[model samples]
Target: MNYKDYYKIMAVDKTASQDEIKTSYRKLARKFHPDVSKEKDAETRFKDINEAYEVLRDKEKRAAYDQLGSNWKAGQSGFTPPPSWQDQYQQGNGNFNAGAGGQGDFSDFFESLFGGGFGGGQHAARGRRSMQGQDSNAKILIDLQDAYTGATRNFTLQDQVVDQQGRTQTKDRTLKVSIPKGIKPGQKIRLKKQGQAGVGGAPNGDLYLEVGFNPDSLYTIEGADITTELSISPWQAALGEKVKVPTPTGHIDLSLPKLISSGSKMRLKGRGLPCKVAGDFFVKLKIVFPKSLSTEEEALYQSLKALATNSDKNIEDEA
Candidate 1:
């Protein structure tokens, strides 16, 4: 048997209001009521329409049917609920006897979601049971800019489903997720009904995505704090000057203190993230020299070395 999409059968969007659903169902039902309609397949269409209306009109039943997802299209075959499906949706003595006009046979799909376990109101619990699906988790890597500014990301996964032949198969499922601004590594985002489908109409489990930063050589994030290294020339460290530095959001001019040493840090308060209780952005200085110097540059360094040597000798003699 194939999974049926009640929303498609009712010719209404899944988001349609209950009144809208009822209005559409009436029009469709009257057109193919099998008594006054001349449309082909009127009898079959009438039953199908009524069946869909019965489920959609009830809030709890509609919500449970929605757990099956909209992927199950009308006229599609060779699909059924998982083998683990059980009969448990109709609780206590509650029964699914309601149908359009108080009379109409329900489909197997409906029975699966709502138990068909009542025969003349006697206890006839025959079929698989129902329960909430197991929650699932995954890790997602995002860019540094994503942390600074909210962004969207897409991910694909292999999910297990039972085919009509009672065998489990893997299918590729893609999801587009939103990454909120100021989200830190190790944080998780919850997606409802994106995990394993609940058995026999129980709501599907939630999916949680743990966020992490994509590998970047220039910057790193810890908690809400952001840190990056700024390379500077030896002269810039000694003389101090304004330099353009790269930040997560953009570049900005930063002044270095004179005689600043390598590993010295400069901080931008409330620039890290969250936009409230914001962390600080730290720029660590790294002073470096040219591997090969020009002749004039080499001469300047040589003179400085000689002057340093003379000064040390004079100090020693004075002592």
Candidate 2:
């Protein structure tokens, strides 16, 4: 398939905010919306735009795309890959399984880069009972950014085979795969015809890829929504004020409640994954105390302590 510039189609910067992306999508979607547009080929162009937006607007998919780098121009010819190319360029940083690309409906270029294929009609009949052939599996880990923005990845897979000589050997291969936006952990990608060759053309089993997330994620995902702990000083929580809080989408000014206490939770509506209705972003408050208070600060604390009292009715009555 021809490469589609999702950023260009949406008319937004690659670094555009989630809100900006949404806004750009809405505007373009309206302009090219099949129902309202009068331009010829509007339907096809609109679909392309929608598809591009679908991939670019999502975090996971976008991240995969970013990993592919910006060197390859769409439809540029004179392409040649090196020997043991899969090992040299395979991306395993976030547990991205290169084998998953085998099952997808990709072009020869993509298949050659990744190096696997699904079984043919003849092979499917052999079933799992086929003694010689073994099913292949792979796993890929992706960063939180890639999950939010979508991404393309490259990887290499190796399989060991025992020849008629009774000696075991390893064969290495590689591939490029696209990870869709917003794909969650534990999800698997299947690549057709991207596995070990079937015996006597019996057909090959499908390659399965398991998805995982990396550490150091700014927000922790729970289902559709994302959660993050935000640290605030005691004064900020006691007196409601605007503070910059970090989210997967980036930092934004948040208006905290004046009465918020440590462990209090706040939510940003419709700011999580880019699903149909979209998910929410939840911020859990963590109040921090300043260490080594200054003399002025100590005076203020002492005054406040003098005015604060804890009731001990039982002890008081006994006394």
Candidate 3:
């Protein structure tokens, strides 16, 4: 097997801290993520980054890898572990298991070193029995409007499975899911029997999807409350008026109280998200001045300034 230098792959020094290693791994992972990256070799690079992180992130795996020493370089062909390495690992000194289905994209070298049996150690001597598959977790992004109203969503989930020949393979499965109204961010929806296939006809594992919201340009969601900016002219603040304000359900006429200041908020009862208990919609007033004033508009502003000056002089004379 070829030797793999995980530290070199992550571009981190041997003495790098865990936080430093994580930062580097995340940066490289984003740069090579297949869905977003335009690089030709993004898939391969992404796999490499994941493999490196899987090993280095675990203390047992890192210790085992560090024992391999600096004599062997990455990509060196026909390199094998020391004669006593297997014996040492079998003694329970380097037992490690990947988190959930995170072991899928690892390399042959990693599998040989750490993917032997249950818990990545030698198999137990007890008789084998059918076992249920492991549960899987994933995050799904939805529009803010979807949370306001129930919607149907389609998702393609990628799963990893070990074949009869003990080779890991990836399978894609599509599912149509119904998103219930009032589902908030960080809430999870569970789909039963949708995870990895069970061994020996045992029941399949469950899939848990954590919900997240896509950023909305019009509104900011806070818990059940929704806030939006309402732009109004200076005269509208000085003299109250009824204005049409947009809400999640629809637009409603809002009465702007006289002498309302910029950054003042108006509440629309039961007009936010359609949850078990409806949330309030808030409109934060923003006083906007005209970008440029016409000659006629400028004269009006001058007249107001003279009136204010005359009123101040009259007060001084009375004093």
lDDT agreement with native, every candidate: 0.74, 0.64, 0.76
Model 2 residue 219 CA deviation (Å) reads: 2.5
In order of listing, the candidates' clash counts read: 4, 48, 0
TM for every model, in the order presented, reads 0.59, 0.53, 0.58
For TM-score, the strongest prediction is 1
lDDT (Cα, tens digit) per residue for candidate 1, span 1-319: 7777778888999999999987897688668855457899997887787678767887766765676554334456866664433444444425453442212455676666554533223222321233345467788888988878898989887776778986667888999999998888898999999876664455787999998888889887888898899989988998999988888888989998899999999998888876456889999999989999999999999998999899999999999
Model 3 score (lDDT) = 0.76
- Can you tell me which runs of candidate 2 are displaced by over 4 Å? 1-135, 169-172, 309-319
TM-score of 2: 0.53
TM-score ranking from best candidate downward: 1, 3, 2
Q: Per-residue error at 233 for model 2, in Å?
A: 0.3
- List candidate 3 segments past 4 Å from native: 1-127, 162-171, 313-319
Q: Candidate 3, which ten residues in sequence have the lowest lDDT sum?
A: 121-130
Please report the TM-score between candidate 1 and the true structure: 0.59
Candidate 3 per-residue lDDT, tens place, 1-319, comes to: 7888889989999999999998897688658866557999998887777778877887877887897755334467887766776777644542465432232346778766665552643232110123344466788888888889889999887766557986667878888888999987788999998865654455777889998888988899887789999999988998999888887667889889998999999888887878888888899999999999999999999998999899999999999
Mark the 10 consecutive residues where model 1 has the least summed lDDT: 119-128
